[model samples]
Target: MILKKIIEMKKVLVINSSARTLRSHSRKLTEVFVNHWKTTHNNSHITFRDLGTENVPHINENWIAAAFKPETERTGEEKEALKISDIYISELHQADIIVLGTPMYNWSIPSVLKAYIDQVVRVNQTWKLNPENLKNPYIGLLENKTLFVLLSRGAEGYGKGEYNEHMNFQSDYLKTVFNIMGVHNIHVVAIDGTSFDPEILKQTIQNSHQNVKSLIEKELA
Candidate 1:
């Protein structure tokens, strides 16, 4: 008798932070990634979060207090205050892979994306303070996850050792943040020089799309 092999469905979490819907190059990259990923992992479950259109609340005093408090000791009000944060953290925990697409705003990520980050980086949830080591006090909770960051910039030379590398705060900052959360397998694909001539910009975008496809194939293989 011949037996069929079973494949487990993977969970993917996709986050988009581009404010522009139609003209957003970052969004386009994410679309390409999702489409290609679906072709390979047809049974995978995908969860999408759009910070561009969604109102991601910034962390406030109440949120800070709630996150620091012990989970069992949290009051009704504190739980209410952390409702959004809990949801975001839950998604992060449930996802086997995470894909984030964002545009560079003032050499950093979009404010909405920043807000989402603030919501998820919770104390005793995503990370913990390690007093044993002062140099590295952070102990990340989430482990063995893959992350893909699709970035779009208006100008060029923001890559490593490039002319504008000194001014780049987007890619490195994101890597650091996710690394602190225990996601070590991170890949970044950037589409730069959006302000360039139309034909040049088109080619740049196509190159990024190819890069995304290649990355997906390598990762899935």
Candidate 2:
């Protein structure tokens, strides 16, 4: 009889994209995720990247040149331009799960999070483009990576058939971006109405805790 090998604890990378450090609803929900994860998987390790404090730099001409150039032919400055990107990509590569704690800003994600994404999604490294296939030209390299997104909104009715369904660009945008990166296993938990309605905000947060708890349990189990 052959014995099946049990799965080991997973590496979790937490990316905090909230600009507000002290009083951020997204950050609060993320804490719930992290705490629950730690409790469930005692042996698992956690890596953190707080975009609120460590703002990622946007990709520039030097970065594009370095990324497109062959590894052996890159100059010192070109290599330097890619150093931060390399670090961010390295972190992404090592993680089995990624948690993004983000607050919706003006119906979309914060600029810092976009900057973070730009740094890691490198051409010929993280993904590849095939112009011949117009329908599906890009191929993502990262496989089996899962994403957990905690979104905090200012108002209510952002869900399907809700009052503000068309105004929700945050979750939809993230889904597209991660799908492009080859991550199809995505889970999103939203807590809206923090500033719009007090009662809705309270209830949403309460419901979000339950959702977050169940998500972690499912992952660990």
Candidate 3:
């Protein structure tokens, strides 16, 4: 009999960006994903980064100078400005999978999540720039990575083909951002209208778990 090797994800980076620590639906859904993932891939390691508390600072002039400068020529002060960004990019590069815990704020992702995206998506680091190639200008270096997003919405009808589809920017924005970084495999699990009623919230939780399970099975298959 021939034995088949079971491919499993090794390194996972979980970014929890909910400002509200307690009673955050996004965080709760992310926990479900992690636990379920653990059952299938027992050896998989997850690095949890809670942006609610450990929020990365926005980029400034010093950071830009360091990022544009040749790595070997960067001064001490310039390097210091890009310190956290380097760490973030390193983690992103190392992870086989990335899970994001985000709540829909004003029809889009939370500001903290946006900030995290801004810090990691760099010029020469995550991607290569060639203005000459007008057809395919920006080139991405990172590849063969997957991203899972657990989103919570206060109101319903946000997904495509839904009533308020035009207003749905949470997943769309993330897709644009990650695609630019070369990670094209992206999945989103949303719990919508959690604030509507207790029954709705309960149903959304159950449905999200089902969605996540189906996603896992499909991906790992």
- Model 3 spans > 4 angstroms off: 1-6
**Better-scoring candidate (lDDT), 1 or 2:** 1
Worst 10 residues of 1 by lDDT: 1-10
Better candidate number, 1 or 2, judged by TM-score = 1
Give one digit per residue, the lDDT tens place, for model 1 in 45-139: 89999999999999888788888878888888888889998899999999988999999999999999999999999888899899999999999
What would the per-residue lDDT of candidate 3 be over residues 1-221, giving only the tens digit for each residue?
Answer: 11112445468888899999899999987888888888778567789889977857998888888889898999898999999998889989999888988999998888887888889889978898889999878877678888998899999998889998899988888888888889899998999998799887898889998998888778776
lDDT of each: 0.90, 0.86, 0.86
Q: List the residue pairs that clash in candidate 2.
A: none
| Model 3, position 87: C-alpha lDDT score | 89
lDDT of 3 at 36: 84
- Which wins on TM-score, candidate 1 or candidate 3? 1
- Candidate 2 on 1-221: residue-level lDDT in tens? 11111223578899999989988999998899989877766577799999999958999988999999898999998899999999988888888999999999999899999998899889877788989999988887777888999999988888889999899989988888888777889999999888876776788899998899898777655
* CA error at residue 16 for candidate 1, angstroms: 0.2
Clash list (residue pairs), candidate 3:
none
Clashing residue pair totals per candidate (backbone < 3 A): 0, 0, 0
For model 3, what is the C-alpha lDDT against the true structure? 0.86
